[model samples]
Target: MENILHSPINNNTLSDFISAKDYTVSGNEFSIKIDEQTGLLITTPRPKAEDLGKYYESDDYISHTDGNKSLFEKIYNWIRNYSLKKKLALVESKHPKGALLDIGCGTGAFLSVCKQAGWKVKGVEPGAKASALAKEKVQESIYPSLFDAELNGQKFDVITMWHVLEHMPDLNATIERLKELLTPTGVLIIAVPNYNSYDALHYGKYWAAYDVPRHLYHFSQQSVKQLFGNHEFELKETKPMIFDSFYVSLLSEQNKCGRKKWFSAFLMGLESNIKAQQTGEYSSLIYILNRK
Candidate 1:
């Protein structure tokens, strides 16, 4: 598997990788060339943590929650949060009242829900402001980084990384660390966008999920399974993050059409979901894994 070669897929820019020093950012500069081999779209020369941190400096780090959102934004967020909570509830149903660890737990939304559900919850968030806000909802202080968590001796019953695995720089190291942190019976949940989804095919480069620089790897079902299997993990089940199609479609439409096309986006999203149901390919998917 280490010898697998990735052929060029596409070149991508950072959407805003400009600086005064370099008036011209080349494809090799701030942009990444996505390469594909065995269904995995790998970003070349994974961006450094320091380089990536600048992009998430603002409140919009965790999707559209910048400031006082508009009525529509508020409504949209409620729907998204409700869907997320439902998914977490499913996790809770399986491992009731167990210790849970959420990596890259942005603002502690899920942690808040898990706490209320009687789960001993802890979170690791890299952002300063978001971690501070998360601390308000969770009694445990969130670690600034995964390494700082010092979870070596601590075992958790459940570990979750929602849309975070793709951003990791070292896939092998991260997976190994996750395995070490989990109890013998612990389950690992990872959610990521699928490059093989219909929406990805429709938007191509403008696909919101490509999210270059920030999202270093684009994973398909096959790729995800292979990666996990290589690290001694087995897939237990997979669930679709249904609402993600609509949200991703809306963002893709904005990127492609250069404006809001809510109606068109909704129609595309519906079509995408329908196709996914028939093919088991979703815009975003939640994968449940356990040590093999």
Candidate 2:
């Protein structure tokens, strides 16, 4: 099955140039094609794998993977202070209290923050090592896969997908399922890399956010809103999560041309910060959405 959809443009600034193409995998529907012009995924209900290896245990953290108490402490502190702050802000703004779910909750960083803030938290993660680490760090029950987890008929006030939505092959179905799991006034928080950001334009295919086959879909702000709109969700607010630009750009610059460009990476990091403050279209974005 195939569907061709209009490309998503940035607030009608540029002509639509991207096209979206949907495909299927093992009887599950998913999108695999993205038009560079409009930056939209054509398919709606696509199939995706639930494999955990695709996201957990990066090469950078392999050395500190185990028995590195000091290293883990440092990492925990950094994430707790920074990443968790942004995530909490989103949750506090919308839900304030009640149960919360974090899909693809790597390392349970955000969950720790939520727990500290007194919100009941649960998560679904596929990565074994990461899930184990998360279990140790947060002490909360985490399901290995969202599809396999039984919610015990419990509903949540908020569902978060930080940088996890793009990895999904069945974007539409996933959204629908999340809707069913939500309370009538529940909110869903989604954060993903924005392909239409200035950094993406500057870096082109070298953009780090385009993590190849792993990032099944590249979404722009407009495209994401449209996706949610079709699924009976309302776009409550959108904000650029600027920190990822520097982090992703650093990785991209280091891996540029198969060589680590430390200096170039530093420059990219600086550039990302400047662009984020000025334009509010950083390399990544957080979307706060509510069911209609």
Candidate 3:
């Protein structure tokens, strides 16, 4: 484990933020710290990259798992289905249909949608079951890791990481590599949860988005801009993933009481979104960037 004293995005001192629990797998508590410079939150004594896989070995980790018997899982699937088209539209609105790369493209659902719209797509998913399922959706090869995805010097016009950036262990190296893989005029879209959001502050340590340990980094708007901007990626736009607030709050409600509370979660989600409209700080934000 690396007991980091400085923020990866900026070499600034870190201060204690809160102690969060791993409600998904273990009840073990983990401490979180914030980058005094960029406001990014990080889990100290972070699990090594090799050992991180074990944390995700659960049926509840929706993105990697296939099980959907539970009602929450069913809602997750429906939201995913509806969001696929919205994702496609967001990509098309950014740039003309060209080569696209979706890191952590679980099950290749978004890629399949892009392919159906006449755009070439490729995916990278490290999970065994999810990668295998992804292969069924898109005929194109699904690489196990971004490092292993050799493209014969090909570059993508658009690259997306939906709710995926926080899990990456090699944050700085990943951004450098993303730059290498993009075309000169390509667009990069990344979506991550905001610790500055209303729900996050309200739930404090119990915020479900802070799925401690597994989510290695917690990004604030300043952190996102500073980290990527340091690598010369210009911020293009910021959009909200409104539905995420509801979903995350639902899980958070369960985390607090160990049982589902749909109504209260919905109210919290709505209140969070409403408050976000005034603050421009959505629970989850999609940041689009380009080389500068």
Per-residue CA lDDT of model 1 for 167-273, tens digit only, reads 88777778888988898889999999987789878877677777656677778887788789988899989999888888888877777777768898898889999
- Give candidate 3's error at residue 54 in angstroms: 0.4
Alpha-carbon RMSD of each model: 5.8, 6.4, 1.1
TM-score of each: 0.86, 0.77, 0.98
Top candidate (TM-score): 3
Best candidate according to lDDT: 3
Candidate 2, overall lDDT?
Answer: 0.68
For candidate 3, write residues 142-204 as lDDT tens digits.
888888847547799999999899999879999998999999999999999999999998888
**TM-score, predicted candidate 3 vs. hidden true structure:** 0.98
What tens digits encode model 2's per-residue C-alpha lDDT throughout 111-189? 8889888999998877777788878878988887767648747689999998888877667778878888899999888
Give the Cα lDDT of each candidate: 0.74, 0.68, 0.91
What candidate 2 gets wrong by more than 4 Å, as runs, is 1-32, 35-38, 41-80, 276-278
